[model samples]
Target: MLSGRLVKWMLLLSEYTITYELAKAVKGQAVVNFLAAHPVPDNETISDDFPYEQVMMIEPLNLWQMYFDGASKISGTGARVIFITPQGDLLPYSFTLVIGVYDHTPNYTRSPEEYPSAANSGRLLKGKVAIITGGARGIGAATAKLFALNGAHVIIADILDDLGPTLADSIDGRYIHCDVGRESDVESAVNLALAWRGQLDIMFSNAGVAGPFGSITNLDMDKMKDLLDVNICGMVHGIKHAARAMIRGKRGSIICTSSSAAIMGGLASHAYSLSKEAVLGLARSTACELGVHGIRVNCISPHGVPSEMLVTAYRNFFGKADMGPEEVGRIVGETGSLLRGRSASMEDVAQAALFLASDDAGFITAHNLIVDGGFTSAFSTMSFIYQ
Candidate 1:
């Protein structure tokens, strides 16, 4: 019976193999006919998701903007350049681009630090009060501005005294100095939020560190512990006090920042992964505990967001302390996503936080909204080194 079953399986495989080849041929022919009928449009309105893209052209290189830092140019040290590919993907010149045709010189333009948004009016979280940890810059600052733009009263909470107050002032929001690693700071921030608005509508625990980025074998327990304290305990503190403040209102949204490292190993440093994974566990635990109080607890796990945190991580990883943020950004953005032509940005992650904070995600809880552009799901078959 086993032999018979094997024979049957072999027959099935033979039929499938034949069918697969036939299907491929038919699909190829169809794509050829379709493209033959269609004319290639210009840059202003060209679509990339076309069929039979086994062959590509130079239009891609034409779109990219090359930039070298002013300091590097003055130093005359070979003049390194970062390529902003397709208005989104930042790819370093050294990085391989398998465009099926290919290839760059130099063209400096506006940085991709600016992002377009879907929420224009201050209506999504209108009248809602929010505490955004790490709101001084990067994803946190972007979320704060987006939140304020969408009508939420944003409190920029961070240890960055210089930038935090400025960001809050720009948005007409308040700024609170919070280390996040300290429960007291978190509690105080929550209290301040409640004191200002009489209720806490949202708590976005977005602050995190890269944390001693190198081999797991070469690690310091003390440094690891500190990373965990900031990444895990910080999230816990936010959930705790936010829950306390939220229970009063009987409805609040709590958003925690995890990393792609938590979901996929070697995507980040050992200490960072340990910290972020703990964040997920804490997020799950707090979500279950706080759900009873009508609070939605969720995590946004971004993959290689081009922030100062990641910049430092890459600097450590590549052993290039002299590497600037632009180069770091290009390096990350290149490998960030499985979605071709699209790279996850600070604004993208911020928008996700905003969604979780708003009434839109009222029913979403105990959820991990992975902002990886399907990377963790699809990025497979690596030897899995300790990042």
Candidate 2:
């Protein structure tokens, strides 16, 4: 029995989740002039230092992409966000925004070019500082270079006094001697990182060690303990100290280096695989704990990289002390990798580290990025059946 005009009004009001009682006459809205800066009687005054206090506002969405604000009810309008003081005075979003007391996640996006033009996504870590453990060689070293190239102040933390300092110098970075296996060393690295830039934004827990070829039946408990000390315990120490440093800023990214051996069996010694697998668990658990503090934890698992670690492991396993890295790389590319003709490289792992460290991956946490060319996701090729 409703008229079309009344039905149209109902639809319009429903858009705002508002309801009105029938039998009540429509009311007019009152406009209150708000003072930008003034003291209440016997109370402290407030003011805004943030620029451009206006009717238009910008806010970041849930993790990715820019939050384009839509037209909404204005301050002192029908729709409002309000707060009551102990003295029972009313405060709206506009009032606090005007006074610079609105503490929001986007408020932390104070960086220039935070909202860049459509042509670019902006610099990934333009004002950020990063620390890379095991940064003297291999994947850690590669990532350290990439991080610096992308505008982060890089810290190369490693036990290699000679190589670490040289690499740091090459990238205009600072070198700190740090063995992730030692808690004090890791703690010192984080402290040094904070000292250099007044903030620690990224921590790459890329330090690890491998064990020689052995089955679980022939497991060397002593060697297993040693590898665990470097691989598993080391990553945990990085996470522990990194979290302490990150908690102060209320935001950070921590990346751990695991391996495809963690996903596949018979690929590595029992101890190495066990330690890498343990990293996945550690990243996920700490991610859950530190996510509330805006800190992210993730792992990068690259399969069959031709790094010296794998080369040495292969040399010991096959009793080919004379074999070179290229030969071993070719063997892995042909036999183990699904993507034929191309062996994985340390740079590939470094690129994965870059993505996880950037704001482009803001919502990514507790993730295991397998840069394996589909090695772990498939069964063996079994080409004899096709032949």
Candidate 3:
């Protein structure tokens, strides 16, 4: 009897092989026929016969109005340039200024005295309201802080009553007890954000649990049920209620947190992987439904981050309570990776969520932004080839 994972992989392999072979065969035949009809003699090429070229046009790269501020001081030396596009897009660029022994030519003309920073930087999410599930800790916590810093009125929703209120208070945001497994809790959280801010702009459905692990033969049905309730049904509740509130505004961004295992098999437990995969399908389906109202739906699948849940999983797996983030990151990198040297971080995943929430990604929707550092792009066996 084949395992469930094996069955899934087999089906995927068969479908991919069939489609790829058919496409390759058709293209090969077309190329052969084309060459037969338009035969070329040896050493003959189009370069000599058609020795023609057209003059290229060049335009000034100044579509965005530039704002520059250069300063030098004992504290720091840097130059900040801000570009505001006609469409009201903001781009803040910071560069370090260094004056070395090559004194004849200084990079900057200004004298070292005054200090300058991006104190007047434009807030990407100004005047927006965001509700982040599982915001008390982990990726959701990072995202909540980032959103608040970017000028969004954030509402932290989580079951961690102790930490949730504290984080919310620090960010000047509100906190509500929300066990995503319950539909009423999710609906009420959305309502609270709406009531306080008068509208909902971003919804981050990020609460999830790593379900039962180990062999499929010993899989626990009770644990599987609980996993689906929080991971799948919870996300559904968020999307359903958030979309309703966003419809009133006619514009919003809904982001869900998935796992790298959702796209690639064998990276996580069966229940956890399945739940994350369901999130992608839900986002794609709901995006189509809410697109008319200008509500964008998307999900982010991040590779191993040293979250509380991940740390606990690592300790449980290795039976070592002393195992820290560095050890877990090294193990994950060795097991599955394309890019080396740096492991995926919570901030990286949060930045993805922030981008999708901001107007910079206004045209993006129904997309699964995988933040795996090229792990999904390369075959697992390719590591041996490089060695």
Candidate 4:
């Protein structure tokens, strides 16, 4: 008999977990204190059916003390939580939770002295409307923010309605819950975006998955198919519909999220690499055919952008221990390139997309920008270095 407030807290916590796995980082004592802070209804009794002993054994006071002590350390650091049920099955309670003190700055606070204001920076996309899939976080969120800051009305499409709206609110953009893998949902999202801004100028087909990272010899066929449906077919659907809309409007830009793995072999699992290669082909062919209609089709093959998909892949395929996401990113940055010696960040990829989206790159069509810090080139020179 969970109280309504307890249920609400659990649900919120669960939602947080879905977006990240740090919720699992909350120790037993922290859970108890959190529960105590938002106590259950007076007459309600908690269920004894689950693993109560493991939970009750936590030291509440110690946990609260640790949380406060570590508040600054964890602030703005996205941590995900994963929960397992007594039945030995994985639960869907993965979410990113930020642990930190609150800052209540006024909305009209002056821009930091270091940054330039809109008045000083020329607007590259003054009257354009852009749609970004999976725009709630990671690369998608960064792209949305970049577009809005550059004077474009952005439509943030993501399945995480909460994060999407929060991100949009921060950028003065609009959010729509869209699973881009679903055709109907995508259609609705496009319609919604057009209704808000009267026309669509850029469509970023960036949502994708690495799928379950395992050798082909032992991988699940069903999982492989699911990955293809979302990674490959999803991009295809986005291209098809985006092209149709752009043809009607007589001008547009379509950018897909291909990967550096697409241009080379052995970097990722079989399906992920294959899907990205397919995306490249799709972008090239669409660019050729859609060129007549004034729509530019391009792909950005970025390397190691600290995305959730890449984090999962590192843990799964590399058999790496749970070094924090940042640590994983640092390792990728070191190993990904010889020239820059850093993995491409979300900002790097967004900048590439921004250039392609803007009129500055108007002549750039059917182009595949390898934003991989010379990864492809470095790999080719590996034998020379050894010699």
Task: Please name the candidate that would achieve the greatest TM-score relative to the true structure.
Answer: 3
lDDT (tens digit, per residue) of candidate 1 on 63-87 = 1222232212111011111223444
Superior by TM-score: candidate 1 or candidate 3: 3
Residue pairs in steric clash, candidate 3? none
* Error at 76, model 4, angstroms: 39
RMSD of each candidate?
19.8, 17.6, 22.2, 15.5
Query: What would the per-residue lDDT of candidate 4 be over residues 1-387, giving only the tens digit for each residue?
Result: 454422122223333432122333454323311211222333655453533322211111111111221122112222222335566433212222333222321122332111111111224565688989878998998888778756688888889977999888876788888887788878877887778977889999888877766677898889999999888888877888888788988889999999988988878888899999999999999899999999999999988767887786677656876745786678876777765456778988988988899987888998899998888765644557767
lDDT (C-alpha) at residue 119 in model 4? 15
For model 1, what is the error of residue 314's alpha carbon versus the real structure, in angstroms, after optimal superposition?
A: 1.7
Q: How many backbone clashes does candidate 1 have?
A: 2
Rank by lDDT, highest first.
3, 2, 4, 1
lDDT of 3 by residue, 44-136 (tens): 432332211221111112111211233121221212222233553322211121111121221333321211122212245866999999999
The C-alpha lDDT values of all candidates are 0.68, 0.70, 0.72, 0.68
Please write out the lDDT profile of model 2 over residues 1-387, one tens digit for every residue.
211211011112121232132111112322232112111212222243221222232221121233312312122212211223455432222211111111122222232232232111223465689999999998888888768755678999999998999888876789999878789999999999888999999999998887645566877788878888889999999999999999999999999999898898877777888899999999999999999999999999989888898888789878999877898879988887888877888888888998999988999999999999888897666756866
**Which 10 residues in a row give candidate 4 its minimum summed lDDT?**
56-65
* CA lDDT for candidate 4: 0.68
